[model samples]
Target: MANLLSLFKTSGIFHLTPGMVIMWLISLTLIYLAISKQYEPLLLLPIGFGILVVNLPLADLMKPHEGLIWRFYHYGVQWEVIPPLIFLGIGALTDFGPLLARPGLIFLGAGAQAGVYVTFFAANAMGFSVNESATIGIIGGADGPTTIFLAAKLAPHMLGSCAVAAYSYMALVPIIQPPIMRLLTTREERVIRMKKLRKVGRLEKLLFPIISTIVIILLVPAAAPLMAMFMLGNLFREAKVVERLTNVAQNELLNIVTIFLGISVGATMNADNFLQAKIIFIFCLGLFAFCVSTAAGVLLAKLMNLFLKDKINPLLGAAGVSAVPMAARVVHKVGAQEDKKNYLLMYAMGPNVAGVIGTVIAAGIFSTILK
Candidate 1:
């Protein structure tokens, strides 16, 4: 009987808790979303699998010094390597032409950041510490790597939940933004067409990274790690002389880092840290931040229309939340619902890319103040 009981004790099933089972279900749901709904699959699928992996009773995947995932998390995220690499890939894939074609659209990106600040105060008011509140606030920007980067700095405990929130909402941009876009604007406003953007030369595209790198890094020295790599990737793309380097950054390097980033982030969501009331609140606050950011962007575009002779499509403003092409594509789709002939995609990319910069800048600001 003693030997029998001892043998049972060694089995994972004997040690499993209800919370671990619950985490498994949650992780599986995420996997379903990634596989069936195709929602941020590149990250979510790995994240879900990681969650499942860590929750097994005796696996000890995230067990401090000895764990495999612990090493990945420590080196890739905690040491701040992966997020910058992710940004490098993002910069390589990005095109500044649309943003350069129309400089005024940058304001929409800046305007969308209202939610981040607003949520910072709201989260603080709800009894979270300043550091945790800042982590929660950044979810509104809808940039996963930035959220992870900030969470790793200000609130490492909340990194998994915060990252999941950011990516989940980013995937749901098509569902979330359209309702807010419609709520804020009249049908006439959605149909409004802006003037054609002027042509931007390759010189301007090449110069943007250099000028932006100098200006942004000067203003936010804390942003150097991310901003520097981001700009360098863009420079590689724009230079046209580093096709091999650019291709690797855009494809292989990005793919590898994304896998590490996703799994490492997911591994943090073990039942002990994740199954809390505060986690629920974090998700709620993330949704609130996303909604407010969407609203703020649309309203700002309306306000901008008041001053300018050439009107801007209010739908374009919805793209200012750093979900990249998805946010921009949603903006185009919403505008097309009003007028199929209207081509708002090119115009929307301006704010879409700008939002990426805005979110990164916001993360840098938070790191400076809170770190």
Candidate 2:
């Protein structure tokens, strides 16, 4: 009878806590969002499963050395191997043609980073440590890899929450951005179309990554790992002869790293660390940051229109967030709604890709100041 009682004591049922139950529920919600809503299924599915696994009673998935998930977290995320590699894949897939054709759009990308700074101050005022604030602020960039990299370096404890917040907001770009974009820009401004972009030559495409690598790295040395790998991947894409390398970087390599990255990031959200008032605050701050970024981009474009002869569609400005194709698609859709004849996808891609570079630089600035 005593042995039976001991067995019960050692079982998962006896070890369950309210926090674990809540985390499990949260994980289920994430899974629902992924499977049913089709929101970032590639990421949210693994992350939700990881959260459920970690919060399970006596699963030990997040236990130091013995845990399966813990090993992935330590070796992959903690060491910061996955984020930069993700950037490499992004670079391989990115087409710099639109950006090169419209160099002035870089300002739209830079302006969007206002949200990062604004959120940094807000988080600080809310009593988070400077490092924690910095980590949280990068969510404004809407670039999950950059958020993870900065959080891992500056505030490892907040890594999971920040990553989840960043990626969640990224998946919700279509929902969150349009309302703000519509609120900020007039229908006339949304319908405004600029001239077609100039064609970029092959030589220009080949030199861009090299020149950008030299200039950006010189200006922000801390951005080297991400920028270097990103530029190298772009070089592989532009070089044209390295089809195998480009394919691997964008496809196989990216897929493998994403699996490790998503699961590892999720494992960091153990109930004890995640289910708290602090996480609620983080989510709120992250949303504010994302909204502010969209607003900043649109407002900047409007301001620029006043000085320029050829006016740009303010909707395109919202694409400055580093959510890549999603933000761009949202901008394009909004513009299309204003004028069905309008096609802003390629135009939006200019700032959309520029926003990726802008985000990396912004993260480097945060890392430099905090570290």
Candidate 3:
């Protein structure tokens, strides 16, 4: 009887605590969102399942040096291997034609980075360390892999919270961006249409990745890992002879890494580390960062219209957040609402793609300064 009772005490049911229960609920919520809402299901599903696995009593899934999930976390995230590979896939999939046709839109992408700086100051004021503040601030950039990379390097303790905040805000881009965008721009500004983009030749497309890699790396060497992989992927796509490599990079390679990355990141969210006042603070600051980024992009576009002969729809500025195609789509949908004839998707893509580069550069700058 004594031995049986001792075994029972060691059982998961006997060991469960309020924190564990709460984390289970959180995990379930993430799973529900993934299945029902189709919100980043590829990532959220694996992450949510990981959360469930790690939180189970006596599972030890996140225990250092002994746990299966820990191996994933250590080799992929702690070693800093996954994020840059994700960037490689992004590069292969991206089309820089729109951005090349309108080089000035890069400013809009740059301006959107204001959110990162502003949130950094706010996080610091709220008593986070410089590293933590910077990690939290990068959530504004809306680049999930970049956010994770910076957090893993600078503030590993807060990696789970920062990553969750970044991805959650990214998934909610449509919800978060439109309100701020409308507040910042007039209906006329939203509906303003510009001239058509000029055609970009194959040579320019082929040279862009090479030139950009050289120039950007010369400016920020710390950014080389991500920049190199991103440019390499782009080169593979534009090379026209590397179809197999491009397909592998963009599809199979990305999918495999994403599963490992999501599960590993989620395992870090063990109840003890995740359910804290600081987590709440990080989430609130993340939303602020995202809103500020969207507004800054729109406002900068409005500002530029003052100097340019042809007017740019301020709505395109909202695409300056590095949420990629989602931010661009939001700009298009909002513009279409204001004027049914408005077709802003392609125009928005210029700043949208530029925003990806801006976020990476911003991460490089932060890593250099803080690390």
Candidate 4:
């Protein structure tokens, strides 16, 4: 009996404690938010599960390079393989017609990226190394996969802080964007009506992604993996004959990738690695980046309106932050609050899609500078 008891204690399999259990409960809160509040559950669910698994105190699941979780951690994540795959899914899901129909909003998308750069500098000032700062700055783009992709490459150690910040700020887009939008634009600017979007033909839709892939790859070769894959997935969707592939990209492929990616990410968040003062700084810098991105997008549009015959609604600029349809919808809702007849959903999509492209470009820039 004594030898058996000693063996169990030595293994640490029976040493589960109250503090570790509490951490598991806290992680569950993240899961509840993802599941109940509908805040990026695709990521939070598996991430939450990973946290629970790793924190069990007795589980060998995260034991460096030996455990099963560690294999996933080393294979898919450490080598920067998952982000491009996830981007393919995003590309398959994105509708670039709105962006193609309105090219001017592309500038708004670029303008929103100013926040990303600013956050990079801010994080550096706060004492993060250049690579770590760059990873955190991406949170302003509100592109979860891009952030994960970059963090995995540049500062794998900071993945948890960067990923959590990216997703959390994405969920708060409706909340964070509106106040900045309202503060930047006047009632008249909010109520400006936009011309109806021209119907983008199938040829244009197909050419858009193809052309984008070529141009971006030529300009920023580092973006090829993410951008090319994204365009290919989009091509699959727009090809008109790949329904099966598109459906898989949209549902099965995306869901499965998200689950694996999330858990893999969470497993990296062992207390020794995750609980740090730098993480709090990263979190603050992320929020700072998000707010600045919102403000920059709105104000840039206001500036553009001064020189154009057709005034661009400043509200649409908020959508440039890349939370996708959510940011666009927030612009639509806030505009509707000012004048019920005003509708900006279609117009907002231009910047919304641009934000996606902008974030990818930002990721490319990070990849280059980090290299």
Superposition-based RMSD of candidate 1 using all C-alpha atoms, in angstroms = 0.8
- Please write out the lDDT profile of model 1 over residues 165-213, one tens digit for every residue: 9999999999999999999999999999879889999999999999999
Report the CA-based lDDT of candidate 1 relative to the real structure. 0.95
lDDT of 2 by residue, 16-40 (tens): 9999899999899999999999999
Task: State candidate 1's TM-score.
Answer: 0.99
RMSD of each: 0.8, 1.0, 0.8, 1.7
lDDT per model, in order? 0.95, 0.92, 0.92, 0.87
Pairing residues by index, what is the TM-score of model 3?
0.99
What's model 4's TM-score?
0.95
lDDT of 3 at 317: 93
Find the 10 residues in a row with the least total lDDT in model 2.
73-82
Q: Please, what are the lDDT tens digits per residue for candidate 4 over residues 1-371?
A: 99999988877558776656665775888899999998888788888888788877767797877888878877778777777888888888988888888898899999998889999998888888999989999999999989998998899899976898898899888888888898888888889988788889999998988898989999999888889989999999999799899888877888877877899888777766776777788888999999999999999999999898888889988899988788999999999999899889988988998998899999999999789
lDDT comparison, 2 vs 3, better candidate: 3
Clashes of each: 0, 0, 0, 0
Error of 1 at 329 (Å): 0.4
List the candidates ranked by TM-score, beginning with the highest. Answer: 1, 3, 2, 4
C-alpha TM-scores of all predictions: 0.99, 0.98, 0.99, 0.95
Q: In model 1, what lDDT does residue 357 have?
A: 93
Which is superior by lDDT, 3 or 4?
A: 3
- Give candidate 1 regions above 4 Å deviation: none
